[model samples]
Target: MIGSLDIAIICIYLLAVLAFGWMFYRKQTDASSFTRGNGRLPVWALSLSVFATFVSSISFLALPGNAFAKDWSSFVFSLSIPITAFLAVRFFVPLYRKINSDSAYAFLEERFGRWARIYASVCYLLTQLARMGAILYLLALPVNSLTGLGLEQIIVITGLLVLLYSTLGGIEAVVYTDAIQGILLISGAFLCLYFILSKIDGGFGGMWQEALQNHKLSLGSFAFDWKSSSFWLILFYGFFINLQNFGADQSYIQRYMSAKSVKDAQKTVWLGGLLYVPVSLLFFLIGTALWVYYFQNPLPEAIPADQVFPHFISTELPVGIKGLLIAAILSAGMSTLSTSVNSSATVLLTDIFKIETANSLRFLRTASAIMAACSIVAALLFLGVDSALDVWWALASIFSGGILGLFLLGLLVKKSAAKLAVSIGLVFVLWTSLSQMFPESPWAFTLHPNFVIIIGTTLIFAVGWLLRKKD
Candidate 1:
C-alpha cells in the first residue's frame, strides 16, 4: 500500500508516458518513424535521452551503496567514459552517417559483408538481452519492497506499462518519455540529497570532510591490482570502455542516430557529458550525507547499509515528500527500462532481423512485438541478483570490449574483411568470458574482469590481423 501521494506521482508518470506515446504515434507512420523517431529530434532532446538511458534504477540504489562502502573510489570506473564520448562523435557518427542505415550493425554489412552485419546484430541482441534483464531486476527491487508486491506481479504490471507504450509508439514515444524522465530523475536525486542533508546536524560539505577523515573517501589503488576489485585494472582499460558504451552500444548510439544531423548528435553527446558529471556528484553527496545521518541516528542491525536511502525516505520525510521520492525511484527505473526495451526492439528489426527489405509500418510493429517479448523475458530472469552495480560491471566485461573492437575495426581498419572481424572479435569476447570464470592458480593477478575483456579483445584482434597478413 503506497501513500496516496506516491500513487499519484506514479500515475502522473504513467499518464505522461501514454500521452507522449500518442503524440509520437501519429508522427510515426512507417518503419523509420518507429526506429529512429523519424530523425527530427534536436541535439538537446537526444542528449537528455542519452542521459536517461544510462542512469537507470540501478544507479538510484547502487550509487548510495557505493558511496556508503567505497568513497570517491566509487567513481574510478567513471574515468573511462569522457574519452569514449569524444570518440563516439568522431569515429562512430561519421561512419554511421555515411552508411545511412537505420541500425548501427548495418554499417558492418555495407562495409564488410552480409555475414559481418548478421554477426554484429547477434552480438548486440545477446548483450542487450542480458543488459535489459538486469534493468528489469533493478526496477523490480522497489516494486518488491515498496508495495510488498511479488517480483512477478510487479514484472507483469509495471513492466507492461513501460513495454506496451514503447512497442506501440516506437523511438518517438521513447525519446519524449525519456526527456521528461530525465528532468524528474535529476530532480529526484537532488531531492534525496536535500532531505538527507536537512535531517543531518551539519550540511553536505561538513559531512563530506567528516567522511574523508574516516577514510570513506578512498578511490582505491591506481596501480593495477588484478586481485582487488577496487584497483586500477578497470581504469587501465577505461578509455576503451568509454568507446564501446557510448559508441557501439545500440542502447546509446540509437539516441544519437535519431538526431537530424551529425552536428546535432555531437552536441547531444557533449551536453550529456557536461550535465551528468554534476548529477553524479549529487548522488555521491547524498551517500555521504546518509553516512553521517546514520551515525547520528543509528539504524537497526538487520537493515542493510544499501537500504539507507530508502530507510531515510520512509522514516525521515513527511508522508507526502516520501511519496515523491518513491515516485522518483520509479522514474529512474522506468526511464532506463523503457529505453532498453525500445532499443532492443529497434535492433531486432533493423539490425538483427534485417527487416531492411521493407520500410513499412507493419514490419516495424512486428519487429517491436518480437523484440520486446524477448527483452521482457530476459529482464524477468536477471532480477535475482542482489547487487545492481555488480551486474552492470559484469555485463560490461562480457560485451563492451568486443563491441568496441568491431566498431573500431570497421571505422579504422579499412581493409579488414568482415568475416575476419566478426570471428576475431567474438573470439576475444569468449576469451574474456573464460578469463573471468577461471585463472591459472589462486595467485593469478585477478584483474577487473572488464579490464581483462577490453584488453583481451584489442590484443586478440591486432594479433589476428597481423597473423592473417603474414599468411
Candidate 2:
C-alpha cells in the first residue's frame, strides 16, 4: 500500500489541476472562447498540448506493458507519427485553416455534403468515447490495485475531476493542463528509467545484454504473414492510422484551430511529433529495463504485463517517487479525458446542432457534461477487457476507417461522389466488422488486422474514383 505522504501528494496534484482549470473559467464567456481559446496560446505550449492529447494513459500504461510482453514492434507506430504529421502540416492544416471552421468534419460537409459530415462526426464521437473509456480503465487499474480503491470509484473520481476542469476552463484549460501533464509524464518516465537502470547490476550495458539475449530487442517478425504482427504490417498500419489521427480526428484539428496562425499550428504538429518519438522511446526502454530488472529479481507469482509496471511502482519505488509517478499517470488520463470532452462538445455544438447564439455556451457546457458522463459509462463497460491497448487500437482502426476513407476520397479523388463515398465507407465498416468477428475465416484470415485501415481507405478512394461517373 502507498504511504500517507503518497496519498497527500496525489490529492495535492488533483487539487492543483482543478485550480489551474478554474483560473480559466471566467474567460469562457462564449462558445468560441470555450472551444478554441483566445487564439493567443504560445506555439510551444500548444505543441506540448498536442503531444499530451495524443499520448494518453494508454501510452503511459500500455506501451510499457507492450514492451514487457513483446518486442519493439509497437514502437514503429510512434515512428510513423512524424511522417504523418509532415503530410498534415503541408496539406491538412492549411485545408482546415482555409475552411476556418470549428469542427474538423466541416470540410467533409463542404466537399462530400451533410451526410458525409454527420457520418464522420458520429465516428469521431464514438472513437473518442471508446478511447476515453479505455484510458480511464487503464488509469484506474493501477490505482485500484495499489491504493485499495474500487475500480469504479477511481474511474468516477478521475473522470469527474477531468470533467470539472474541462467544463470550467474549456480548451485553454485543456491545452495548458495538457502541457503541464506532458512534461510531468515525460519526466516521470525518465525518472523511472533512471531508477530502473540504477538497480540493474551493470546498469545500461547489463540491461542491453540481457535484452539482446532474451530477444526482447527484436523489432518484430519480418515475415509477410498477415495473421500475426509484423514490421511491415505495423508500419503500414501506423502510417495510415496516424493519418486519420491528424487528418480526420477532431481532437487534433481542434488543437490546430486553437493556434494563433497557420504557421504556429504547423509548428505545433511538427514539434509535437518530434517530442513524441523520444518520449515514446523512453516508455519502451522502461519496459525493457523492467524485463531485465525482473530477470535478475524474479516475481514470486505471475502477473499480467499490464500490471507489471504498477506492481513495481507499489513494491519497488520509494514513497514520494511512487506518488509522483501515479500523478503522471493521472495527468495522462486527465489530459486525454479533458480533450475528449471538450472536442466532442465542440463537434456536437458546431457540426451536429449548428448552434451559434448567446445560449451556445450553456449548450456547450451541458454537452460537455453529457459527454463526460457517457465516457465514464463507457470506461466502466471496459472494466473486464483484457489488453486495453490492443482493444483501443482495434476500435480506433474500425471507427476511423470510414472517416479516414471519406477524408481521403475528398482529397485524392476529383469529382468525388458523396453517395459513392458513403457507400464505400459503409463497405469499409462491414469489412471491419466481419474481419474482426471472423478472423479465422479464410478470407479474413489473410487480411491482417493492422492493414484494415489501409485497405478500407484505399477502397474508399478507388471506388469513389471508379464510380464518379455513376454519381
Candidate 3:
C-alpha cells in the first residue's frame, strides 16, 4: 500500500478545505447567505462551482475503470452534456429566475400549489442524500486501501468533516471549496493522462496498438449493449442522465442561482457542457492506457480493474507524484460534498422551510443545523449501497420524469390541462420505471435505460397534451 505520504496529502487537502470554509464564513446568519451567497457571486465563480459539483469521486476513479473495461462508447453519453446545458440555461434557468425563487421546486408551487412544492422538495432532499452518500462510499474505497483506515470509520470521519464546515459557512464556502477542488481535479486528470501515456512506451500510437491487440482500443464502444453498456445504446442513455441535471437536479439549479444574472448562468452552463467532452475523454483514455499497461505488464495478482488507476499510481509513480494523486482524490470527494451539502440546505430552507417568505434568522440557523445533521445521517446510510453508478442513474431518472413535466407544462401547456398534465405525467414516469424494475421484464418494450427519461418524459407530456386538447 502507498502509506503515509498519501494519508498526509489527503489530511492536508481536508485542512485546506476547512480553511476555505472558515474564510468564507462572513457571518452567514440568514437563509439567503446560507443557501446562495447573497446572490452576489460572479458568473465565473458559479460556473466553476457547477463544474466542481459534478467532478465526483465516481468520475475520478470509476469512469476510467468503466471506459477501460468497456471502450470509448462512454463518449456517446458525454455528447449529451452540451445539449443538456442548453436546455438548463435557455429554459430552466430563466424560468426559475423569473419566479425569482431560491429553490427550483418553488416553481412547482407557483405553477401548481403547496403539495407539488413539498413533493419536489422532498424528492430533491432524498436524492441529494443519495448522491452525497455515494460520494463518500466511493472515497472510502480509495482511502481505505491506500491508508489502512476502515471503511466505516472513514465514512463517519469524512461525513463529519464535510458537514461541519458546510453547515457553518453555507453557499459561499461551498462554492469556493468547489472552485478549488474543480481546478485540482481537472489538472490532476490531465496529469494522470500524461504520466500514464509517458510510461506506455510508444506515445499515443504505440499505446493504441497495444490496446487494440488486447481487444481494448475499440472506438466503437457503442459504435450496441450486450444487455449492458452497449455503444449506440449508451448514446441515448447518457443523454437521459444529462437531461436530469440540465433540467432537474437542485444542486445544478442552485449553482445557476448563484450566477450574477440569468444570462451569466446560461453562458456558464453551456461553457461547462462544452468543456465536459474533452475532459471526459481523458477518463476513457486513462482507462484504455491502464488496460494496455496491464496487458504489456501484468498486475502483480488478481487486482480489480476498478483498482487499475490506483495500481498504477501506487506502484509506478514516484513518491511525490503519489502524493499529488492523493490530492486528486480529495479534489473528487470534497468538491462534490461541499456543493451537495450547500444545495441540500438550500432545498431544506427555500423549498421546505419556506423561509424566504418570512423573516427569521434564528429559524434559518436552526434549519441549517438540522440540514447538516440530515446530511451526515444520509451519508452513513448511503454507505450501505452496493453499486454507485446504478444508484446514481436511478436517482436522476426518477426525479427527471416529473421535473421534465413541470418545466414543459409550465412553459407550453395552457391552464385547462395543467393539473391533468402533471397528474398523468407523474403516472407515466412511475409506470415506466416500475415496469423497467421488474425481474421478468418483457422484451416487447425493450426497456433500455437509454429511454428511461427520454421516453418516460416525452410520453407523459405528449400524451397529456393530446388528451387535454380533446377535453
Candidate 4:
C-alpha cells in the first residue's frame, strides 16, 4: 500500500497545479488571450510547453517499458525528431507565423477549399481525443496499482483535475503549468535513474554489460524491410508524423502563435525538439538499468512490459520519494491532457463552430468540458488494454489522414490541391480499413503499420501532382 506521506505529497502536487491554474484564470479575458496568450509568452515557456506536451505518460512509462521488454527500436522513432525539427524551423514555423491564425487548419482552407479545412480539423479533433484517452488510461495504471482504486475512479479524478486547470487558465495556464510539470517530471526521471543504478551490482558498468549481453541496446533491424519496425521504417514514420505534428497539428501551431516573435517561435521548435533526444536517452537507460536490476533480482512472475516500471514504483521505492515520482507520472498525463483540451477547444471555436469573439470564451470552455467528458469515457473503455503506447501510435498514424501531404501540396505545388481531396480521402479510408480490419487477409496491407501515414501521404502527393494545373 502507498504510505500516507506519499499520498499527501501527491495530493499537495494536485492542489498546487490547480492553484497555479487559477492564477491565470483572470488573464484569459478574451478569446485571443485564452487560446494563444496574445503572442506575449516568452520563448522559454513556450519551448518547455512544447517539450512537455511531446513527452507524455507515453514517454515517461512506455519508453522504459519498451526498452525493457524489447529493445531500443522505438528510440529510432525519436531520432527522426531532429530532422523534422529542422524542417519545421525552416518551413512550418514561418508559415504559421505568417498566417498568424489560432487554427492551423485555416492555412488549409486558404489553399484548399473549406472541405479540406473541415476534414483536417475533424482528423485533428479525433486524434486528440484518442491521444488524451490513451494518456489518461495509462496514468490510471500506476495509481490503481498503488492505491487499490479502480481504474475508472482514478481516471475520473485525474481527468477532472486536468479539466479544471485547462478550462480555467486556458492556453496560458496550460503552457506555464506544462513548463512546471516538465521540470518536475525530468527531475523525477533523474531521481528514478539514480536509485535504479545504485540498486544494481556494478552500477552503470554492470547495467551496460547486461544490456550489451542481452542486446537491449539494439535499435532493431537495419534492413530494407517494410513489414517490420526497422530503423529506416521508424525513421520514415517518425519524420512524417513529426512533420504532421509541427506543420499541421493545432496543438503545436498554437505554441507557434503563443511565442513573442517569429524568431522566438522558430527557436522554440529547435529547443523543444532537440531537448527530447537526450531526455529520451535517459529514459531508455532507466529501462536498461531496470532490466539489469531485475536480472539480479527476479520478479515472482512475468508482467506486461507496460506494467514493469509501475510495479517497481509500487513495490520497491521509498515512501515520500515514491509519492513524488508518482506525482511526476501524474504531471506527464496532466500536462499533455491540458494542452490537448485547450487546443481542441481552440479548434472547435476557430474552425468547426466559427464562433464570434463575443461568445468564443464561453464556447471554448463548454467544448473543453465536453472533450474532457468524452476523454474520460474513452479512458474507461481502454481499461485492460495490453499497451497504451502501442495503441496510441497505431491510432495516431491511422487517423493522421495525410495532412502533411496536403499541406506540402498546397504550399509547394501552389495548385488548388483541393481537387484531390476526395481521392485522398478514399485512399485513406481504403488503406486504413484493409490494414486494420483484415490484417490476415491476402489483400490486407502487408507493410508495417507505421507505413500507413507514409503511404497515405505519398498517394496524396502523387494524385495531386497528376491533377495539377499550370499556374
Best by TM-score: 4
Query: Any residue pairs clashing in model 2, and if so which?
Result: none
User: Could you estimate the TM-score for every candidate?
Assistant: 0.91, 0.96, 0.89, 0.98
lDDT of 4 by residue, 237-288 (tens): 8899888888899999999999999899998999988888889888899888
Q: What local lDDT score does residue 341 receive in model 2, on the 0 to 100 scale?
A: 96
- Please identify which of the two predictions, 1 or 4, would achieve the higher lDDT against the true structure: 4
Q: Which residue pairs clash in candidate 1?
A: 73-219, 133-379, 226-446, 226-447
Candidate 2 per-residue C-alpha lDDT over 211-329 given as tens digits, one digit per residue, 9 for 90 to 100: 99999988898887766779888888888888888898888898888999999999999998778888888889999999999999999999888889998888889989989999999
Flag regions of model 1 displaced more than 4 Å. Answer: 356-360, 417-428, 431-447, 468-471
lDDT of 1 by residue, 1-471 (tens): 468787777677678777777777677677777778767877777788788776777667777777875676756666666777787777777667666777777776765677766666676777766766666666666556666778777766766777677777888788777787888878888887887887777677778778878887777776655556654665655566656667777777777778898888888887875566677667777877888888777777755545566667766777566667766777777777777777766776776555554555666666556665665687677655556666667776675536566666666665655456556666656655666677685634455555655665576457545544311
Model 1: lDDT of residue 470: 19
Q: Give the higher-TM-score candidate: 1 or 4.
A: 4
lDDT of 3 by residue, 155-232 (tens): 778777777777667888887777777788888888888888887878788888877777765555542453465666
Off by over 4 Å in 4: none
lDDT of 2 at 226: 63
Task: Assess each prediction's global lDDT (C-alpha) against the native.
Answer: 0.69, 0.87, 0.71, 0.88
Candidate 3 Cα outliers beyond 4 Å, as residue runs: 3-5, 213-228, 356-387, 399-401, 416-438, 441-446, 469-471
RMSD of 1: 2.8
